[model samples]
Target: MISFSPTEEQQMIVSMAKQFASGEMRKIYRQCDENGAIPEGVIDTAWKMGLTSSSIPEEYGGPGGEHSAITGSLIAEELAWGDLSMAMHILCPALFAYPILEMGTESQRKKYLPLFSDEKYKAATSGLIEPRFGFDPYSLSTTARLDGNEYVLNGEKCYVPLAAEADLLLVYAAEDGTSHAFIVERDTKGLEIGEREKNMGIRALTTYELSLKNCHVPKENLLGDPRGYDFNRIMNCSRVALSAMAVGVAKAAMEYSRDYAKERVAFGEPIGSRQTVAFMLAEMAIEIDATRLMTWEAAWKLDRKEEATKEASLVKTYADDMVLMVTDRGVQILGGHGYVREHPVELWLRNGRGFATFDGMAIV
Candidate 1:
């Protein structure tokens, strides 16, 4: 099984995230769910705790975290156990932050990095997908044409989380039929944001439609690779984090089911006394164990700087499905209580349905 036993530093981070999440973030979870609003300070506390910057390097005044794929996953799992949306929001900056730190020019980093920590600026999102299709970025329809010192971008992107609240967009656009990435500030000419999408799951995260009507971006905003940018690598690096979130949701389901079974009465006694009920819990344990092993293997491969695309793909796909089974069973064990809006299990199931959607985890 994938071992989650953390090292001294890893354990310390886990404990810190666990403590804070159980306290502050836990209280606000349902509030955000009910109101579909994430408080402004949600990301601040994570940043202050250094958990949000766990993937960033020290050169950028960050925690100097070594890009260990497993470590970040561990952190994500812990934070997500309390609330998935909050966990995602805390780590969302990495989507944009990573590309800049890895590929941005000194001038680019100096200008954009400072905005991340500044509450006045809010956050920036990585806009890579298009309305044309999902998962495959190669199907991009956006065009970026060089015009003197700047590039003019025209295209629309959809389903990007944080697009509504982003101050800048790290968008992927085509340059002479070659894929290139552009960092378009929100105020850029002809840049427009459509209405927030009404999604069934992860409602706290507001997805948006980005319209760039011949938008003009400065020359310096481009990152590395003049040719088409590689979305596979970006998605691969993010796989571990996604698995960790699933782990968190699964862990929550397991614990909730166990406790509910123990207390819930049945025909003869508490449901926990039933052999059939015990068997279901046993199955959950098995899936969780297998998924953990796979997730860690993928993370270790990434830490060793090896190609983990297949391993990550395998884990993300199975883990998402496993969480659905586990959570659905949790609801079954809860009987009427699980289906009611008063319980969190129903919400967990709704949120879980999409975990397998993004990044092409479905039947791929």
Candidate 2:
């Protein structure tokens, strides 16, 4: 009993974003990859478009509506079609905003939500995953202890996106042998950022190691339960973004493969005329349709107050893998061109890899 039709307002927002992303975001996407710096201007346009600030509260001077997933998913797919790396960079503040919106105190929300609205201030990196811990949020080598109303944290968090440039950090640590999330601002005395890890794709967003040496944080910065505070809203907003990203990437790859198969002559006729090539595109079509539906279903469930954790994981798992399949076939259809940087299938392949293991892919 759910509907995915866009309201007039939502449709207008999507159209406007599509226009802006096509015109402005596309131009900078390749430049960012070439220069190895995800510029602020690309994301500034997204913020002006209200893409990242949609998670903040409307009362806090943000769009902040509860039903942002549809619009967000729409934009994510489109942006990924333009450039996956730049789309991810534009969403940096968004990833941090989820934890705050779900777990922040009024003061914390007031303090950080405005940062997203500013279009200039980038937020912090999330220190959730560890080299040893992986996605198992409960198991941990990191330790945080309360001493005289100040929390002393000691840990090393790795693969943290945007760690080099993050202004604040949300570190997950164990206190009294129980896991807790700590809010550590940038420039803290004991916190040190490591070199950026060179990812296979999505280089526009940086990942690095964070060494927290006796990092002391105020008691008030604690977000939710050390062990119990999971932003377990099943319509998990982060994965929602990822699902849309996959759909966008897959859509583009599918189009490329289909077009290439049609024009590339093989055995006197177009390869697309061949049963094998046409079937490949056909399979891609089916998977893309399914992926889009799953994403829409999860987003739709999220826009309502419904149980969507299962649906979200399903979408994440299916779309995460589907994008890879579509893109790989896209490369196959293109033969040699797919392997080269001239085509974006390689980047799509790289982008799809990160998402494959996220959102409980191992468990699923």
Query: What stretches of model 2 exceed 4 Å from their correct place?
Result: 63-67, 119-121, 133-135, 175-179, 224-229, 358-364
Worst 10 residues of 2 by lDDT: 355-364
Which digits, one per residue and each the tens of the lDDT, describe model 1 over residues 258-360? 8988998878689988989989988988988788778888878876767778998888888889889988887887889999867788777777776765541
Looking at model 2, residue 150 earns an lDDT score of 93
**Candidate 1, which segments miss by more than 4 Å at Cα?**
1-4, 54-59, 117-122, 132-135, 175-179, 225-230, 360-364
Local lDDT at 258 for model 1:
87
Candidate 2 residue-wise lDDT at 351:
74
| Model 1 residue-pair collision total | 3
Q: lDDT of model 2 at residue 127?
A: 76
* Deviation of model 1 at 20, angstroms: 2.0
Q: How many residue pairs clash (N, CA or C atoms closer than 3 angstroms) in each of the candidate models, in the order given? A: 3, 2
- Candidate 2 lDDT for residue 48: 73
Per-candidate Cα lDDT values, in order, are 0.74, 0.73
